[model samples]
Target: MRYYYAEHQAAYRRLGREGMTQWNDLFGESWTFDDFPNRVFLESVLDRLPASGEVLEYGCGTGPAACFLAARGFRVDAIDLIPEAITLARRFAQERGVTVNFSVQDVCAMPVGSKQYDVILDSYCLQSIVTDPDRAAVLAAVRDRLKPNGHYVLSTAMYDSDRVYEDDFRYDATTGICYERSTEPADDAVQLDNTWYLPHRRHLRPKALRAELEANGLQVLSQQGELRGDVICTPTRRG
Candidate 1:
């Protein structure tokens, strides 16, 4: 089974430099934690952040989100698994004169040296950890990195039912490894266009996710369905 780290590395390579440029073009300004303009998911999360506090954004991509938070006067730390991504994010922050601590480190293996953050933002990254086994360790690591009363906000796709693909799917929740069979069609089948290249699909149901959080000592502050999108979970550390 492919580990989460390996899967992410492949994705990073796929994005390469061109993908980063595309992201900058699409977002215009640096991305923020709760960035979507009219989405209730981000709006609710933004409402929870302190005006100025220590913030950590996991999977910060090209650093747009970290830059945005820094511009707002919050101390920000952003991390991504891709070295090139972190380099681009650092350059972006430097050009914008926004001070953000950017690093290339796996969130599960972060060497943060016992530091805890006031808010941890996981904007669509957790869904990438599709394996059930890896989820526990990742959640535990996140919990350990948060301070008392710290907030965690995350958005991820949810699946209503089980599915099987023409290809292979493998996931391990213990290590958070998620693997998928290639979407390529077999011989004798009609040549499928790459229009629908679904990379991975392991979704956490809202009820199940809430139960997981509570079991891990996180208190759900508010959870809302996001405009026909995935459910957003905003939870606070138990004091």
Candidate 2:
């Protein structure tokens, strides 16, 4: 892992730490009020999820979505790379009186288990695997973890617009990595006491994402793209 990723992973391990606290202070309440509205990319996934079943959430940061599903009577298992995130999620579940299992594990190296979930939710996490070398393995691991006929819900931001900005932006269609320079000032301002800089954003194009999913065992059911408009895609498992 690079220095940034290592630091991020370490910060994640201590959820109640200053770093996570600041992050939650910045965006926690927004998710707490309504997960569906804020998670625009996951709208399709939310729509396709079964009302009551075992649901696994990848990168389930802070567990708002898992809590939302649990409140609605679904059994949820939420996982994230950051331990601190998982700890906070667990606390959130306890506070809400919901039973949700939050685990701190890397998506790329998900532990083996006999059980498979009915639905798997991946909201804007895969896109964060910015480097080319890691994308294939991450996708494959997700596929292997899913049950046959299971549903994999995924949402990613696609950059295809007429609007232009005066910042450094780079997009690689082959690797599906999008890097954008940040314009935030260096004040070290704390959002929940987390002083991390938000520099680049990465995601896959619609076509590339579909291809990767299909190459694994997942088949596209319906897909929608949201820029100024909503383009949703929902895919079912193949055999």
Instruction: Give the CA lDDT, 0 to 100, for residue 105 in model 2.
Output: 76
For candidate 1, give the lDDT: 0.62
| Per-prediction TM-score to the true structure, in the order listed | 0.70, 0.71
lDDT of each residue in 134-220, candidate 1, tens digit only:
566667767777777778766665543444434455443433233455455532112223322323545555667777777766777
Rate residue 228 of model 2 by lDDT: 20
Candidate 2 lDDT over residue span 41-150, tens digit each: 55445656667888888887777777878888889888888776777778877878999988877876666677777777765566566544456666666667666667
Once fitted onto the true fold, the runs of candidate 2 whose alpha carbons sit more than 4 angstroms away are 2-33, 36-48, 160-169, 179-201, 228-239
Query: Where does candidate 2 have its weakest 10-residue lDDT segment?
Result: 187-196
Candidate closest to the true structure, highest TM-score: 2
